[model samples]
Target: MSSVAKVVRSARGLLLRGSFKQAATQLRADISTGPQQQHGTFYEFRTYDIKPDHLSAFLKLTDDNIQLRTAHSELVGYWTVEHGGLNQVFHIWKYDSYAQRTAVRAALAKDHDWMSKYISKMMPMLNSQDSEVNYLVPWCKLGKPPKQGVYELVSFQMKPGGPAVWGPAFQAAINTHDSPGYAQLIGVFHSEFGDLNKVNVVWWYESPDKRAEMRHRAHGDARVVAAVRESVTYLVSQNNKLLIPTAFSPLN
Candidate 1:
């Protein structure tokens, strides 16, 4: 099987395990960033399952309409899943405020050309039945971009009653850490997608060695251990990729 297939399969496996704490820990390790950096009110972890023939059309639409016209948020880095999952596309968009999100959606909806050309092109390829939009809970600190490196992206789908218990432990872990590669922790508000029981956290690493250092820290961190033990119910999906900013976007 192809490497992409392996990744998709691994993500699916994590999802199937349904352990929120495990997922959160895994996701923290997977966090990485792209070129376009903006903090504050980052929204939407939009995932799509596009049809093969329509993939090109979808990319073109995203490139032109969503990427080009949307002014509310900058287009950050994104990853195209090729292997384990079935025709998946994942990307992150940053927004300044709730009002901006609303305005951008309205504007996009009214764009006749975008709706007619791009949306129409994507209609056939989209698996509307299983697609998801989850609110993002940012975990990285805000500032100038860090040096380039590989980062892991892991997300936790908290169980209905897990956050209250898990949140403190997670926060404590962040507070106690003094690791070298650990950067910033930002909270994200996910809007317009997914169930309410989920909270997503992203971690940033300066390098692979730093990422490994954090993982080693996690092993001995009492707070992290406690949190994981308390909120054991959740789903986790992980993706590791190099952060690459959009060549044409303002984020660069």
Candidate 2:
């Protein structure tokens, strides 16, 4: 067998032995052994509810003054909800560590340009806001699509035990669709803050119609159905949002 096949076999054996944690531990160890991604990176998901009438102004202000805020930290992506939520903007920020995030927050508070040009003008346009910190799942890396396209954010609230309990099957279900060459799997993130035991799966497609076609194709596949059936047992609730990348979004 090829080296890749051997690795897959080993991973399957570990999972069969009910060692999801052990499998992840070993994979992480192997990653640390090579020149790979840093382990402590965090992604903060921020959602702001914009006043309906001020939505356009909010987007414009953000497009114009976002650089000041981004100078403190990295912006992964910024988007507006097209469905599942209205008049809301969502953005992801990347930080190397919690300390880095704290420092960025402090710096943002002090930056006159960010506060005055962006925050001050942008504040009144919001109804409320929310944030959640998440870490990329051990077995996957963030992915880019074939080209710029619409994205979907699917949030799954799982039962109490966190990734240790649901992660294997959940990842397996995601992989079934991915391996079948369906919609692009952007990333799978496990919540680190806010609501516990939540996982977010991000996907990209050429368009809404393409996404529907891909979903239909996946549902027709027996492997996809089986994997989803297993994963669904751990799911408590789920929600999804269709996102359109903002003009200045890194992922746009």
Candidate 3:
């Protein structure tokens, strides 16, 4: 196998042996290039571990209500994990500030439709213990603009041996491709353990078509193709929604 793939396989072995933090740190360091800071709004990354049966119902509700409309605020992006030794669902919501998030969530909680259709659907499979909610502070040191518009969130669960190969392939795709309706490429992040065993790559697109175009290009790229085949077992999931200023404090 290629050198990158070899690195990934080794990493995966380490992760399986319970060295999650070590594997993650190695991957982060391998792909450590670009400005240290970028322009972007703070985000709340919420993670959930749903029941296998309830997955479909929850996704349906999200697509119908949360992903499609902007009644409360922008959806920003969404993703779900299917394979790769890890099983979970994750989505990112944008807010103008912490306060706005509080208000919007409260409103959503009270929305009769959301209560009847959305919440009721996922009550069965929801894993209350493993779920998490956290704030993402973008690397503001870089001058890149904060991404706006519809976006897709891709979360990766890198095994101990996967990072060396996957990291470069991912970076190459993001840097070289011409994303059709893509607004910007947001920062990537490592997952917090209480959350799940994963890391994330956030992509910004103006429309679904644009997002598709970028993915097509990335998949077609020799580097990404090679990386996918050799380096890691990955999972991708997404949600399409608008982002708005948080209505209230998530902390409060």
Measured by lDDT, the strongest candidate is 2
Q: Candidate 3: which stretches are off by over 4 Å? A: 1-40, 67-69, 85-87, 129-186, 189-200, 203-252
Clash totals for all candidate models: 27, 0, 38
RMSD value for candidate 3: 11.0
Task: Give the Cα error of residue 134 in candidate 1, in Å.
Answer: 6.2
Question: CA lDDT of each candidate?
Answer: 0.52, 0.87, 0.52
**How well does candidate 1 score on lDDT at residue 48?**
70
The TM-scores of all predictions, comma-separated, are: 0.55, 0.85, 0.43
Q: Regarding lDDT, does 1 or 2 come out ahead?
A: 2
For 1-252, candidate 3 gives per-residue lDDT tens digits of 644556577778889999999987765665443233242345567667777677667666666766323578765445554333133565555667658877988887888887776677666768652333333423311113344344445556554333333445455444444233223656565444333435555545565676667667777677556545543444343333322222121210
lDDT for each residue of candidate 1 in 154-204, tens digit (9 for 90 to 100): 455554433333444444444554343344433333323566545554445
CA error at residue 64 for candidate 3, angstroms: 3.0
RMSD of each: 13.7, 6.9, 11.0
Model 2 spans with C-alpha error above 4 angstroms? 1-38
- Which stretch of 10 consecutive residues in model 1 shows the poorest summed lDDT? 28-37
Write one digit per residue (lDDT tens) for candidate 2, span 1-252.
433345557877898999998877775554334222348998999999999999999998888888888888999999999999999999999999999989889988998888888888999999999999998988889888778899999999998855655666888899998887887899998888989889999999999999999999888999999999988988999999999999899987
Q: Pick the candidate with the highest TM-score.
A: 2
Q: Give the clash count for model 1.
A: 27
